[model samples]
Target: MKKFGILVVVFIVCVAFLSSYANADVETEKISLNGSTSMEKMVNALKEGLEDKYPELLIEPQFTGSSAGIEAVLNGTTDIGNSSRYLKDSEKEKGLIENIVAIDAIVIVTDTQNKVNNLTTQQLIDIYTGKIRNWKEVGGEDLPIVVVGREAGSGTRSAFEEILHIEEQCQYANEVNETGPIIAKVQSIHGAIGYVSLDVIDETVKPLAIDGIQASEETIQNGQYSLQRPFVMATKDTIEKQNEEVQKLFQYIQSEDGQKIIRAVGLVPTSNKMSY
Candidate 1:
C-alpha cells in the first residue's frame, strides 16, 4: 500500500509539471511593423486594440514612407509594411502583397481662421498648381495662399497629386515630411493650406468642402468622397505564409472588434473586413 501511494504521488507531480510547462509556453512574442507615415493612425489603432486582447504581443510600428515599407517586406526586413495607398504594379511584380486595412480620405485643410470653407474640385487643383496664388482667388481673405504639401515619394503626396490630376505639376510653397508638422506649420502661417488624412484633422485646422461634400466615413463608404484611398499593409507573402504570431495580428485587424477601432478613428473599415 505504501509503494502504491508513492507511485500515485509521483504521477500527480509529473502531471502538474507538464501543465505548468504548457502554461509557460503561452508567453508573448514581438511583432515589427514598418512604413507609411500616413498609416500611423490606423496602425496605432490596431496596435492598441490587439495588444489589449493579446497581452502576449509586443508590436513595434515604424513610420517610413509607403515605398520603403513595401521594399522592407519584400526584402524580408520586416514582417509587415503599412501603406496609405494601394500597391503599385511595379511593386506587385516584386512579389509584394497589399492587404487593405481601411479607407481614408485626403482632406484639404486651411487655418481655422481662414474664412474659406468650400472649394470646388477645379479650384483645389488650381490652388495646388499655383494658378490661384491668393486666398481671395478661392473666396477667402486677401492673404496669399501658401500651398503646403508632402515631400516627394510620400504616399499622401502621391494620392493627393494623383487625385487632383496634377501629378508632378504641383507648385508648393513649402513641402513637409509628416502630417503632424504640416498642421503646425499651417496653424502658424496665415492663408496656409495643406492636405492630410481625414482622421488627422482637428480644431487646429478647418477642412474645405470638396464639391459641396465633406469627407466623412459615410461619404468615403458611399464613394462620395473623391479624395479617398485604401489603407494597406504589404507583406512578402500571403497571410498564410507569415509566422503564426504575425498571422494572429492580421486576424485581429480583420476581426469585428478591430473594425470598431478603425471606425472610431473616423476612417472607414473595408466592407468585407479586409481588401487589396
Candidate 2:
C-alpha cells in the first residue's frame, strides 16, 4: 500500500510538470507595429493571417505615418514601423533597422467628377503649389484646382515631395490625417486632387496618369510608374537585439508568404535584390 501511494504521487508530479512545460513552450508572442496609413489594410491582413496560423500570437498595429513609425521604432516605442519610403542614412545612424517588405505606386487621384486623366510630375508640382490653379491649364475643364495633401510626417507625402523636389516649396491647400480622409475628400470635392497608395483608390476617385503612364498594377510592376516606393518594416534595438518574439514576427513578415500578402493588398512586392 505504501509503495502504491508513492507511485501515484510521482505520477501526478510528472503529469503536472509535463503540462507546465507544454504551456511554456506554447506561449503566445505579441508584437506592435506602427507607421504608414498606406499600409493599414495590408498590416491588418497580416495580423489576421498570422493569428489564424498561430493563435497564440497577437499583433497590434498603429498608423501614425511612415516617418512617425520609423521614429517610433527608433525611440523604442514600437516593435516595427511601416514606411512607404526607405530609411534615410540619418535614420540608420540612429540605429534604426529596416526590412523592405513591399513596393507601392504613389497614385495621383482626383475627384471622380474631374475630367483630368493625366499629369506630368512637373505639372503635379505646379498644380499643388498654387502655380497652376485651373484644370484647363493641364488639358482638363476650366476649374480651380483644390490641392489636398497628407500631413508633413506622412511617408506618402515625403515620397511625393521628394520625387517632385517640392519637399520645401509645394504648398498644400489642405492637410488630412489619414489616407481614407484624403480619398473621401478628393472623391467628393470637384477639382480636388491628392495622392495615396494604389490600393486606396476607388471608383469615386479617378487615377491620373503620370508622364503618360497610368498608375496601374502592371505599370507599377514594370517600373513605368516612376512614383514607386518601397514599404519598409523598421525596428529599434529592442526588437533587433533583445526580443526573440519580435524576431519571429519580423521573420514571418519577410517570408515569401508575407510578400504575397503584401502584393494582395494592392502594393508591389520588392525583390530581395533591392537595398532596404
Candidate 3:
C-alpha cells in the first residue's frame, strides 16, 4: 500500500514537467540517449519512429545505469540521459531536469512454482531485509525464499529499494547486473523471487499483486497500483531549454504517436499526451 502512494508524488512532478514543456518548440534533428538498460526497450521502439519522422536525424542510445545516465548529460557525455527512476534532488540541484518518457511499475516476481502471490509493502520490506526468511512467513510453502535482485547501481534496484525504503540494506541472495538475468534466475531457480519493470515480465516468472492491486496497464493508469515509477530522460536545463532536437524527441515521447509506441512496449502512457 505504501508503494502505491509514492506514485502521487511522481504524478504531481510529471504534471509540472509537462506544463513546463507546453510552450517549447518540439523539433530537432538528432538525439543521443545514454543510461538505464531498462529504458533500452522503450528507446528501441522509439528510435525507428523518431528517425522516420526526421529522416536526417540520428538516434543513438547506450544502456548504462540511471545515475550514470543523468550524470552523463550533466557532464556533456550525452545529449539525453535515459533514467528508469526520477532524478534525485541532488541531481536536480546540479541543474538536471526530468522529462518523463513512460510509466513503469516495479513488480515483484516469483518462480511460477511458488504459489504465494500478493505481499504488503511491509511484508516486502521485511522479506528483502532478511527479517522474513521463508516463503511460509508470507503464506507460501515452507521453502527458503531466494531473493534475487539487480546490482547496486541498477536503476531498477534503486527504484525498488527507494520505493520500499529498503535501500542499502537489501539482503539479496544474488545480485545480478541486468533485468534479463534476474528474470532468468527467478524463473529457473525454485523459490526464487525478484523485481523487474512491468514491460519485461514474461511467462517465465509470475508477477504478484501488491495488496490486491495487479501491475497492469489499467491499474497503473488508474492509480490503483503503487509500484509504478517514471522512465525519465534527464538533460541539463540550459541544454534542454536551448536544444531543439532534444525538446522534439522529448515532446514526441509525450505525443499521441509516442504514447502509442510506449503502450506497445507494455507501459502506461501519461494522460497528458502532447502534440507532435
Task: Identify the candidate with maximal TM-score.
Answer: 1
- List where candidate 2 sits over 4 angstroms from the true fold: 1-26, 237-242, 271-276
Q: How accurate is candidate 2 locally (lDDT)?
A: 0.82
TM-score, prediction 1: 0.88
Comparing 1 and 3 on lDDT, the stronger one: 1
Q: List the residue pairs that clash in candidate 1.
A: none
- Order of candidate numbers by TM-score, starting with the best: 1, 2, 3
Off by over 4 Å in 3: 1-29, 238-240, 271-276
Candidate 2 per-residue lDDT over residues 49-88, each given as its tens digit: 7777678888999998898888888777888888988789
- How high is the CA lDDT of each candidate model? 0.86, 0.82, 0.85
Model 3 lDDT tens row, 3-34: 77889888999998997797344554667889
Instruction: Write the residue-wise lDDT of candidate 1 on 1-276 in tens digits.
Output: 999999999999999999999989997798898988988987888898889988989899999888788788888788998888878899988887778878899999989899998999999999899889888887777899999999998889988888878998999889988889889988888889999998889999888889999998888989987999888887876788888888888788778998888898888887363433
Kindly indicate the candidate among 2 and 3 with the higher lDDT. 3
Instruction: Flag regions of model 1 displaced more than 4 Å.
Output: 1-27, 271-276
